[model samples]
Target chain A: MTREKIIQLVNQIFIEQFEIEPDQLTPEKRIFEDLALDSLDIVDLVTGLQQKFSIPLRENKDILEIRTLNDIYVLFEKLAAEHPDIVAKLNKEP
Target chain B: MKPRIAITGAGIISALGNSRQEVYQKLLEDECPTRERDDWADQMYGTYQPFAAAVDLPVETAKTISRHFRRSMGNAALYATLAARDAVAESGLSKEALQSGRVGCIISSTVGSPGEIYASAMAVLRNELQDLSSCQFFKIVSHSSAFNVANFFGICGVQLSPCSACASALQSIGLAYEQIKLGHQDAIVAGGSDETTPIVLESFRFLNALAKNPDWSPSELSRPFAEDRCGLVCGDGAGIFVVEEWSHAQARQATILAEICGYATNCNGSQISQSDGASIAQCMRQALKDANLNPEDIDYVSAHATSTPSGDREEASAIREIFGDTVPVSSLKGHLGHTLGASGGLESAIILEMAKNDTIIPTKNLTRIAEDCAGLDHVTSSRPKRLRTVLKNCIAFGGVNATIIYRLADF
Candidate 1:
């Protein structure tokens, strides 16, 4: 919903699924070189992000231009801006 | 001359226990490992049969494996990797020899985790296939067990994975022996593994082939060769062995456990569901012929009697026609229940123990032998027997029958 929530959820996927450390997941950290994930891991990354954010990301052509962890945060934030309904629903206190 | 095959090491994880000694101890104590699962029936669609089962999962051992490999593994693959590690450790194979490009891997399973398949199918039906885990396909493939075993151990040659249901383990072991006999490889890790999923239990129940727990306790369900014997009780586990060429093992000065003298596998070609004695007898006869030994040379017979009425009858009748009520016969299913694909490797390990310890484990719960399964010298109690030559018979669905012979090799 917010920048902090988006960062928390995206970093959680990297930590849990790919066994990356929290300190290593900086905004400027390159996902491929710093995270040690090869090309084979991109499919799982996309699936994990899509399932987490509840958005269809495969159709998004802009995903090809992504490089760093900050790019992921920016993309999720942009999507949230486009769909205000998700912001309200995700931000509502459970 | 064919190169002799030596079983240098063995490992197993079964309902009875994690090792061959534990399985033998439980069998000596006359304990049954099958138990009831309270949550299992809910998975079945109103077709509950109270199917008895035994499941021994090595959660701690499984956690030790790397996630890169573990992510693609199911229960069967994990069990196999654990067992293979134990077998290799006991063999004391050096890293140089292990990675020398001369070793092979042959692991078999009835199928990949049916539970993963069921879950993936549900995800597909719900139109969430794109969100599925990328490694899900690797876990559900038929060669998952073999590939996982090879990748974990770094084995480099002659990889094979057979999916012949109950006969899978024996077929894999037999293939390993053939590989060594042909001088194609110096050694091979051969075995089979399986997992106890709700679907496997329910499918057996639908075919009236699963043991039920009604008046009797869950432990007393699998009664192989007995008159009131029920059908097979499901159990999950694995068995893997290091089969090495005799010259190679001798050169390495390895501790030889047993010598695989003979192996023969054949298709019944007549019935896919039911077993016939004539074809089973032919399989045994072929193995004996391969070993150049007569029926009398076999001191014991490890039968594939899974507590099913007709299957036991056919196997027993075949034993009578060939061995003729002698050579002390027994089935481990009486204690371990039916391990399906893992039964051959697991029971073969116990048979090696029988030779090494000079203690023959009798068929548990065989209080009174059935009339149809009579005429064989059915062992009813543990006794002292210096087993030299032993034969293992494994019969599976789809008319697959396998027979393997072993001889004690004095170190």
Candidate 2:
């Protein structure tokens, strides 16, 4: 998927799941400090993103590396680039 | 006798209504709010009259909870938090005072989060566990109601969650009363809450305890102590009370609604579902002894007749053996249906209102007394009587029996 599409999906996920507003989606905002999210919340967000993108984010180290919204978008883009299957799944229409 | 634990405030959320005035007025009007559950008929697959008293949740309560945490909260927790908020608001206690170490919280429920439990089990069975949220288990845990209330109020002292089926709420109240009367705490928020879910009804249906009479209207199906009483109609709601020490309430100039002067809890230890009349009588007598009063001292008794044939007969025999036919008796379940864990707290709150207004409410559909339930003054109609004291009884599935005595505050 394109970067713009990835950002849109991430924004929608955060807004709907965490009740976060669209305006609060700054790249510099810390997920834990600014968003007030704990480790358990991160797990839920990861699970939700995985289901949406159909990408496996299995490693705990990768989850730990994610700190900001920008980091999450970058991870999604990287996964889409590495896995053709995920790219094909994301491109499919509803 | 120990020092009296004063009930400074009481709150309820039920199909009947939320405020004391709403429920009390409905009781006096001889109205039953039960309705047909067409949705349940498809789910239960039985002709058993599927009637339930579902709560009309207040809009403010929904708006007050943030969306982020609201998803984690189950209906039981939401009902509990709303009822606790009302009770605390009425107590006139500041948030600082409520969060103080001198206060305690004791809430209970039969199954804390049945919705979450059902959803989680379904997901697992369907191999869709990957879609479940991380907080799913937290919501379904047995202590969700108590923990959610404590978190909502930032209560940090003496938190307890009783899980004794039908007697859960009364057990919580009795525990809170003991703690405060013994000077363990100055005040306590005590009560129970449950939500209307099909699983709750299904459990009773499995026990062959659901009311199923197609000829009778939904309101008339839950006829406690009546000869035609078939079985219990599952209902959902909550009742919360601010139980405080007498001196503490008096010192704060708070309005004392009633004083919980006596409490007794026992177990039949034989049949889990069927209550023994002998054990129930012992519980009542023990409560009277605890209050240092004779049976004649109680002006009214709130019977835990849940419209179940055997349960009503057992409780009625117990009451007759202890208090004879002089004491006016009625069961609020006739109006609210069987609220399970919340029944005792809900009934007790209404009983306090009855004492305050000098009016006794009769059983809603008790037109004819059953053969096994006769010989007692089963309040047939609302009447004005100077009630000084009221007795409340609760019998749960675990062979548990509990009784509490409340005396009116003259001042």
Candidate 3:
């Protein structure tokens, strides 16, 4: 719902699925180069993100522009603005 | 002339134990691993009995594989990878030798991940396809075990995954023998792996093939040819071997465990569920022909009898037809239940140990042979024997019959 929550959810996918440690979650960290995730792993990451955020992202072309951890958070923020209903639904989750 | 192939090493994880030595020890001690667990297949499938065989302990050896590389694996692949890793270790194959581009991997599972396959399908029904993980698809892919093993060791040679149900491992080893004998590869890691699920038991139960003889002694619950035998008890495990070209093994001074003398596989194409003795006999005869050996040369016949009435009877007849009634015939299923894809490879490892020790283990619960299965010399007890040549037979659900001949490496 919020920017920090979006960052937390994306960070959870990496920490849980990729076994990355918390210290590795700096927003400036490059996803592919620094995190060393491969193409298939990226697919996994996308699926993980979709499941965590409860959104359909397969058609979201902007995901291609994502280059760093901060980019992932910014993408979610942009998605929140675009899909207010999804963010509002999450905001109501209490 | 075809090149000789040597089974340099083998590894197995079975209900009997995690290591070959433990499995052999149990066989020698006449132990049975099947149990009436509360969580056995019957709990979910509501089959007649709760008796099923499973690996008794965690696969500690498989845990050594790093998690990153293991992310794509399922239970079947883990069993296979551990078995392959042990075989390579016992064979003293260096990492360089494995990655030499001349070593292939042939591993199999009937369906890659039976539980995952069903679960992913259920996810579709629930309109929750997005919930599937990134590694979920990889687990259920048909070649999961084979590709996982190859990737685990960085073996880049020919990779094949045979899916012939119970015949998979026999066919896998047979294919490896073909490849190395034909000079296509210097060596091949060959085997099969499978982990049982309630779904696996349900499939067999649907076919009326799960053992219902709950009153029998736990040790006798899966008797192959005993008159009171009911049906197979599903089991899980894996077996793997390092089969190398004879000349190459000798050049490297590797300890050859056994010689892959011959192999043959065929489909009768007529019978889908029942065992076809005529076709099985043809396969065995073909294997003997390839080995340039007569029926009398085989000291034993390891039958693919899964304790089902018709399966045991027909396989007995086939052995009698090919090697006559005197060849010591036995089914290891009585000990570990039916291991499906892993049986042929696991049993091959068993017989290799038998040949090494100059003794042969017998069918565990065979008290009295069924009348129709009477002619063959069914080994009813473990005893010292002049072991050498062994003919391994597998008859699968899809009318596939495979036979592989293994002999002592003394030659």
Candidate 4:
């Protein structure tokens, strides 16, 4: 998946999980402030992403620092570039 | 000059019961509240399979406090308000006293509004942003319980929310003791409340800290200090005490439950999630030293054993090092489960009642003591004994440890 596609997918997840408007979820919008996501919410979101993307996202430190949809999208993009098989797996679903 | 502080009134809502009399009676019978989650299975993140001492509180309690209703408010605030109201009523302090602004409230909780926050997150996922209330964000903060209680009681004095993890409740009470002793307030309503949330349960589960059992009985689970104890069950409730200057309570001829002799709290300043035996020992000694009493002078100890492997071992070692094997120590978590923020307050109230009744409730379900937790006189079976000076200890998640000394109430 491309960067834009990844951002779209991440934004969709945010909209679904946080009821955030698509227009409100900008590249600089903080996950905590803009979306009002807490530490536990962030953990659950990361877990959901890991399962959905079938990618290994172990380290709580890096997962906690994710602020924006773009940050999450970039993370997915990097992981996808490294593991095309997982990207294919993630893309196979809706 | 430091003023003498006393516990004028106390109230509690636990798995055991709602009122003081109810909980005390249940404790005497060695009965505990059932811990089941059949009613909440349909909710998101509702797969918590642990014992909880949940309250059967009414919704009118919340509506009576504030007209503004939001799903953000959890059971924690409701329990705190109920206990606070009972404490104020029992203290013989009218609404006029509360309105005078001479009273403050210090309530603490481990994680505030976990259920509400989790539900809100699920709502957001469904693209339902318009339904979220303005108070939702405030409820997610750790200070929400304190803020809600202060607002409910119309207490304009100093309001504080201490989030010292499991020790949060005890720290709040100890801080209130110091504040009243230093003439900071005429009376203070202090305590702790906690509610079981899926996030809390999952977090503990992820850390491999929750007790997983095939049998769904409350008595069999939460066996603190027992050799076969696996881990602690997650329970929720609130314990509130009316702490005031002895002179103030005496002037009003209030029923004094116990005298606050000495209280001390210290930080390990090392590991965040682990306890340091030396620091724990030092904290106990400091509390004893502050009270000007030797370790042998303490008649009984209410321990802070959460039934975790490391926590139980560390606390046992600390107790043995401080008071040796002679002191009769017990943990109510075995019966009440770990109420987290409310453990200290609930246990303190239990000890006060025990001192009054001259009876010590046994550490229920402690069949075989662990070898590491050996040496100390762990009160297993229920028995009536003479009690004078009782020491209460609490340790929390942020490396915080607190100890308080209580003398039997003398009319």
For this target, which candidate reaches the highest DockQ against the unseen true structure? 2
Residue B366's lDDT in candidate 2: 90
Which pairs clash in model 4? Answer: A16-B125, A17-B124, A17-B125, A18-B124, A18-B125, A19-B124
lDDT of 4 by residue, B216-249 (tens): 4766777778787777777878888888888988
Q: Per-residue lDDT of B217-270 in model 2, one digit per residue for the tens?
A: 888889899999999888888899999988889998998989888999999989
Give the lowest summed-lDDT range of ten residues in model 3 chain B. B40-49
Candidate models: Cα lDDT each = 0.86, 0.86, 0.86, 0.78
* Model 4 segments more than 4 A misplaced: A1-94, B39-51, B60-72
> What residue runs in model 1 are displaced by over 4 Å at the alpha carbon?
A20-24, B47-49
lDDT of 3 at B136: 85
lDDT by residue (tens digit), candidate 4, A47-72: 56765676656563566567776678
* CA-only RMSD, every prediction: 1.9, 2.0, 2.7, 11.6
TM-score of each: 0.95, 0.95, 0.91, 0.78
Residue A56 alpha-carbon offset, candidate 2, angstroms: 2.5
How close is candidate 4 at the interface, in terms of C-alpha RMSD after superposing the true interface residues?
11.2
lDDT of 3 at B314: 85
Q: Calculate each model's fnat, 2 decimals.
A: 0.57, 0.93, 0.64, 0.00
| Better-scoring candidate (DockQ), 1 or 4 | 1
